[model samples]
Target: MKISIPFLGVLFLVTACSQPQKSSEAGDAESAQSKFAHSPLVEHIYTADPSAHVFEGKIYIYPSHDIETEVEEDDMGSHFDMKDYHVFSMEQPGGEVTDHGVALKLEDVPWASRQLWAPDAAEKDGKYYLYFPAKDKEDIFKIGVAISDRPEGPFTAEPEPIAGTFSMDPAVYQEGEDYFLLFGGIWGGQLQWYEDQKLVEGRKGPTDGIPADEEKALMPYIAKLDGSMTELAEQPKEILILDDEGNPITAGDNAKRFFEAAWMHKYGDKYYLSYSTGDTHFIAYAIGDSPYGPFTYQGNVLEPVEGWTNHHSIAEFEGKWYLFYHDTELSGVTPLRNIKMAELTHLPDGKIQTIQPVN
Candidate 1:
């Protein structure tokens, strides 16, 4: 992966911003005093939509690198004009975090145009793969993969995005020898515009013309990845989230339906599928006996935070579980957000205790 000198200069600025502040710095002292469990993982630069994984012996976080922009805010998320990604790592939860400079950027992506969103990382055959969502040159969101020799990456993107992929928030879940891409988002994320595996022309979301109460809720998609992990092994399929009556969650049931940010993890013999209830501002989860699931809605894992958007990833490290999420506590602006993590607890009955974000 070749990086230009100009990009290296930008990395220098990013690194400077990521440096730990001296105690004499008043702002740093003040922030340190008030820091709590839900505080931003890194105060230097904004980050959100954290997709955390325990690679090797350390916890590495792959999150959207949020930047301040003049783009007007809207329900379509135009204000979130992020254009790159950065990887952060730590020895353990609540410990010091090291920001690994730019892993992938829009200028380096051949097929991407703008809006580099949430990303996830996976390791196979001694190589690390970073999966991210970005708007293609045609302005449609597509998932892409970048490769790195190490978990903390200055990754080189593939010449093109993975074919047969759309929408955003690509979360890769590995089980045994198989890897599956779990992805989708509504509204600005563009999941609503797709129908029958293709983008529907002149499509409108529920707020525009579609009746939420009568229509089945849009679902997140999952498809197996071939050994190379760059392309889908088969056509993507919807992972159903069902209500107690075994009915598919309806679009109107915003409190219990899938919104965006799909993450999968296995606990015991059950597969847990968790996601953000976009407008509802909750991190909810469902459980199934298999990876490809008709999961039964369990309950929320996180409550509303300071911001409008909610995204999260769950992983167990060193016999303890943690839920990595983001809120706008630092900037207090919807688009400029930060990532956070809290210890998560699962009960004996397989239910997750709803976590209320610290004020």
Candidate 2:
């Protein structure tokens, strides 16, 4: 039997943004070498925000288990809990997977105290590290790290925040020489940018060049981590605020320009940073030659499909890179999402081919 949990609203946004239009240069998508071989039919797995690490030749997918229960209507006024962590193990060849049961429960942690959200897990040395965002003392959200000897964790947390309240949805990367963590930007009202008091004609608005008037909008941010991968510190360089063509998308009305669900991986000489755009359930991408990027936005990679929001994870396994994401097809057009996968292809010119579900 399959167990279903809800609470994934933005997890499938990449699919929402990745709709395929027949390219003038291509044969049908099926004829393309890069399309996914198959797509799954499942629902409410909330297997959103999926992160996989191959352990001893097995791939495990860990996602927040925000299970809902039948309770009195008066008690229904409650926030979801990240109390359960679900694990899925994939079989070979067909990539068929079996649900591995709840691997960890938040109520099992004394300090966790409240809501749990996105989690990214990786294996280092002989241990598995899981980094996630959860509520701290004042009920404010912060990122924290946990360590376990196995991929399916009974993880233990450190005494402090690995990344501060300003950070969430972290993707950790270790290049040849250093370690880094990428996260969504905080809406630091004071950090916003603006044009001079003398508004320029034809410009019609602030032309300060910083997108979103970084002074007033939420932009994605990154921090460098030490070799130990614990502390989150400001990098030596200036903070990166997501901007489109030197103009900031700073209006409160335009906050969706910021990237969410960001992860960076370097292939050959290029680094691909994938993210979900806005809450419209769309996914977009950018590319950079370096980890610390002057990345050029490549536009939305996935658009909403069926009823699913667009969001995804890119992973390389057994020499193949795949996009792992979720969709809302079976549960109609709501937040209930399911797990899906597709093959990812990179071209010689440093451009990545957009991924789509197998028909």
Candidate 3:
């Protein structure tokens, strides 16, 4: 675990220097009639990053449950060890998906106790929040919010979090009455492991190399949320996902910009944003008009999913447009992944259509 460097040299933060591997533990998870029409609509349970929401009209989701890593051999079990969260409703989008089991857990969050990572779900005025990026009892990694009225949830958290945000994925969007809150991308390391894991906010550069401005890569963070989804209706903005003449497209082998799983939606007058290009496993997008963004990257709606973390959540339900990602091919367990969906096609210059995963 030591990496205090003088020449840790040759190590460009392979997620803090890779070496934790193995995926032979899990065996029984592959049912639901044996999957495959596009796979992973929940094959027993091993879900991953999906956020997905449509709430009252159906399509609910909100994943992150993959707990199959005993850790000991090369240890990276905490690599993404989520504790709970399982809201899975559906009325369409391939139909029949309802596993509303435990909509929030990690000891019911009193400030989170584990790495219950990558989450997002929203609905206001009538209430139904759920947004987490866990690890609190001083394990750091903050960003919380849970309060439910049902979307298949018993949610009711908020022991203290969502104050000045920290790191990890936590998407939320709701234009018109305003409530943005997109979280960070310290997903792999840089900005000096996001300032030595204080998780970004000044004076922490070069945790390895290559940051002469990866298109103003400030380590993914965004804000705007005050109607009591938990505070911070302003003062937070570092999003940089452009590149078409708009600029700021870091080009890390180019999967468009801004890594980490950001996910915002709206499609007619435009305001897309979709993230998770972090270390490039796909799921890229950007094309804003509001909801705070200079966005424009416009490409890859969901392409490279095998696993290294590429989160998602985009809805539509009865009218279609789906893309809730996650996959390590049914838990060969690259950090224990699962959840997958495909079906997003739109054209006429608004652009979006690049799906490929369904083995």
Number of the top TM-score candidate: 1
Candidate 1 vs candidate 2, lDDT winner: 1
What is the lDDT, from 0 to 100, of the residue 272 in candidate 1?
94
Please list the residue runs of candidate 1 whose C-alpha ends up more than 4 Å from where it truly belongs after superposition.
1-37, 204-211
lDDT of 1 by residue, 86-201 (tens): 88888878777887787888999998888998899999999999999999988889999999999988899999999999989999999888999999988888888877878888
Give the winner by lDDT. Answer: 1
TM-scores of the candidates in the order shown: 0.90, 0.71, 0.31
Encode model 2's per-residue lDDT on 1-359: one tens digit a residue: 23333323333443442222223333344453244334442333545567665676877776654334332222111233455666776745244566766665666544566656667777667777777776666544567777788777668777777644333576776676566777652221111221221222333222333343345344455667765666766542322334556443443423245535777777787777777654455666667667777566665556544442344667778988777776543333223345666667877777777655534
- Per-candidate local distance difference test: 0.84, 0.55, 0.69
* RMSD value for candidate 2: 10.2
Q: Write candidate 3's Cα lDDT for 2-100 as tens digits.
A: 222332333433433132222344334353223333666765556778888777777787888876556442222265666888888777776667776
* Clashing residue pairs for model 3: 259-278
Q: Report model 3's TM-score to 2 decimal places.
A: 0.31
Which residues of candidate 3, in runs, are more than 4 Å off? 1-50, 53-60, 63-84, 94-99, 108-111, 114-132, 142-166, 170-193, 196-240, 249-284, 287-312, 315-320, 323-345, 348-359
**lDDT comparison, 2 vs 3, better candidate:** 3
Residue 17 lDDT in model 2? 29
Candidate 2: lDDT of 43?
A: 37
Question: For model 3, what is the C-alpha lDDT against the true structure?
Answer: 0.69
